[model samples]
Target: MSTTTMKYAVTDSLMMLRRSMLHIARYPSMTLPLIIGPIVFLFLFVYVFGGTLGAGLDGSSGGRADYVNYVTPGILLLTVAGAATATAVSVATDMTQGIVARFRTMSIFRPSLLTGHVLGSVIQTLLSVAVVLGVAVAIGFRPNANPAEWLAAVGILTMLIFAITWVAVIMGLVSDTVETASNLPMLLMLLPFFGSGFVPTDSMPGWLAAIAENQPFTPVMETLRGLLMGTEMGNSPWIAMAWCAGITAAAFAGSVALLNREPGR
Candidate 1:
């Protein structure tokens, strides 16, 4: 990274940031689901099935409170997934429109361009998390932990978003079209269904339970839940960080390799 290269990277990143913000400004409707979807999920699960599921898991007859605490982490993860979709779709659109190619033609730092998009996505993810948390509070989902625990919860969620954004970037670069990028987010959204998001893994069938307990999302959600509820994370925090780091490295390496492989001028 020569000074010139570093400068280019920073400049390119800033350009990408400006472009992303402009797109958001131009289309405010897309922001609606950032608040709506998570709220809906919170209401549907916490009110409808929270009683039965909570009772079965917590040994209480109707444990809506426990259910609320358990699912809050899952909902936050889902919000990050939703934000990642936008990142992927926007990157794919830029690639398809030849914008990336044009940038490549210039002396712009290629890595910076991707980094900028990832950074923008991370910012958006943070905003979405804040919105979800606010909604969670409104719906009686209070964190039992002190300020330190709350800070840790934020750190964990930030790490999760950082990792997921790279995955989204890879999808954007590899997908043949923007529509495909649009669909990639659903994969992240579905992880919770198979894990301990809505229910306890112990109660699941043996084989399925094993998989669910060990899945990345399970640990991530458990880590967040533990931090928020001021309870034992039971090995989830470390496992979640490992998963996030591994995925992020793989995705970043793959995306960079692909981008650098293009024919030279």
Candidate 2:
């Protein structure tokens, strides 16, 4: 917690980050799937089912009821979620390896180890998000935001990814094995569908509609959509940030406590 410790932690985190990135570079298959999975969903939703889904919207779900604009944000959220799953798996694998035990004997910054995996995953997430965004742009899905708006959008996505990283860290630490950690975060990927990612909450049944409107993804998606298309901001930006901050704080605390409770896990 001292300035010296803080300085060392940052240095150690960056070093660990480079190590994680090198792993990804060496394992092209691991890197490819995380980037491709969301791209497939984007194409399928926008092409295969877009017309049918758009017809249901009937032009009431903002001007972006056209499937591409309506669903791009959701796919971006999926990209981050998928990256978080990878993060969890990587962390769990590290826990099982001899390296974690070796590090405990060294004088290196301990938290840096976790930060490395999470930060590395975040860089991957941002890369995947950019690829998705590029694909979205190629297909004529215009967000139409100015530079400032685009920056704001990026800021929100960054915070959201950072929050999800902590959650993945906690999952990785507490998991009994890599398989469990890998599979557990699948729920994060499904959450967008349950919320307002693909469609408007108002269009669903009463019970389903209520759930869709209130979930974390719904507000985040709504905020992103509004910012991109220049719609009403309302309270969505604040609400979305609140969710991100709350999750990040809780998950960071829990992950730290659990890591201390179970060393090398």
Error of 2 at 90 (Å): 0.6
Per-model TM-score versus the true fold: 0.93, 0.94
Q: Write down the worst ten-residue block by lDDT for model 1.
A: 57-66
Candidate 1, number of clashes: 0
**Model 2 / residue 199 / CA error / Å:** 0.8
lDDT of 1 by residue, 1-265 (tens): 7998778778888987887777776876666676678779989998998887778766445578777877888888888878878889888988888888888888767787788788878887898789888888887787888889888888888888989999999889887899999998888888887888888788899999998887788998888878887666878899999998998899899889877876441
The weakest ten consecutive residues by lDDT in model 2 span 56-65
Each candidate: what lDDT? Answer: 0.83, 0.85
lDDT of 2 by residue, 1-265 (tens): 8999999999999999999999887877766777799889988888888878877764445333378888999999998888888889888888877677788788888888888988888888898899889988888688889899899999999999999989999888878799999898998998789988887788889999998877778788989988898766689999999999999899988877776565633
Candidate 2 residue runs with Cα over 4 Å from true position = 58-65, 263-265
